[model samples]
Each structure stands twice: as C-alpha cells, then as structure tokens.
Target: MKVILVFLLALGINLVFAYLLALGFFYVAEYFFGVCLTVKEVFFLWVFLLVVAPLIKLKFRSEE
Candidate 1:
C-alpha cells in the first residue's frame, strides 16, 4: 500500500509539472511569437517531464 501510494503521488506530481510546463509554453509562445503549441508539442512536454521528474526525485533523495 505504501509503495502504491508513493507511485501514485509521483505520477500525480509529474502530470502537474507537465501541465504547468505546457501552459507556460502556451503563454510564452503567444506573447513572443503569436503562436500556440501543437498537440505533438504538448505530448512531448508531458513525456519529457515523465523522464525528468523521477531522476530529480532520486537526486534529492540521495542528498538527504
């Protein structure tokens, strides 16, 4: 149960990060270039977050 909860929490955190990053890009692009992200761009950001977030989590854990 603890393991499952931790996994769920990590997944949730990654989703939130991906969403925020996507939204950030949306606004930045609109402001600078008058464009929006394509679906592919959003999907790539989400996948990139999934790959990055766990490594960051582990790095912080090892520092403790």
Candidate 2:
C-alpha cells in the first residue's frame, strides 16, 4: 500500500510538472511553433507518469 501511495504521489507530481512545463512551452509555442494545446492533448503527460511510476516501484523492490 505504501508503494502504491508513492506511485500515486509520483504520478501526481509528474502531472503538475508536466502542466507547468507545458504552460511554459505555450510562450515558446506562441512565438515559434505557433501551436496551442487542447484538453485531450494535455493528457499526453499521463503516458510519462505511468511509465515513471512503475520504474520507481521496481527500483525500490530490489532494495527490499
């Protein structure tokens, strides 16, 4: 349960980080890429968080 909680926390932090990064990208995008994100596209960050969450679990598993 603790590991699961850690995964959830990590996932949440990853999401917040992704959102802030994307928000910053918006400035560069508006100037150069001229691209803007929609709600669906924003969820792309989940793929990263999912992969990361499991990698963390694996890392600690060996320590135990």
Candidate 3:
C-alpha cells in the first residue's frame, strides 16, 4: 500500500512536469517558428515524454 501511494505521487509529479514541458515547447515553437500546435498534439507529446522520461533517467543513471 505504501508503495502504491508513492507510485501514485511520482506519477502525478511526472505528469505535471511533462505537461509544463509540452506547454513551454509549444509556446516557443509558436513564437519562433509560427508553428501552431493544437492542444491535442501537445497532449500527445506530453504522454510520449512521460513514458520515455523514466527510460532516459535510467540510462543516465546507469552511466554514473
């Protein structure tokens, strides 16, 4: 039960991080490149990053 709670908390934090990242990316792209990314597209990118972030972290961690 404690493990599950910790997992939930981590997942929530990861999701918020992914969302902020996607929003920032979207804004920068729109400003510099005039690329108009829809919310749906940003959401997709967020989900993709959320899934990939842990793998990336693990890869860097293993090198250290």
lDDT string for model 2 (1-64, tens) is 9999998987787666556665665567667887776656645644554456556567888899
Candidate 1 at 31: error in angstroms? 1.8
Q: For each candidate, C-alpha RMSD in Å?
A: 3.0, 6.1, 1.8
Candidate achieving higher TM-score, 1 or 3: 3
lDDT of each: 0.81, 0.65, 0.86
**Colliding pairs, model 2:** none
Q: What is the TM-score of each candidate against the true structure?
A: 0.67, 0.50, 0.78
**Of the candidates shown, which would achieve the greatest TM-score relative to the real structure?**
3
Query: Which regions of candidate 1 fall more than 4 Å away from where they truly are?
Result: 54-64
Error of 3 at 41 (Å): 0.9
lDDT of 3: 0.86
- Candidate 3 least-lDDT 10 residues: 51-60
- Clash count, predicted structure 1: 0
Q: Clash pairs of candidate 1?
A: none
Output candidate 2 Cα RMSD: 6.1
Q: Report the lDDT of model 2 for residue 59.
A: 80
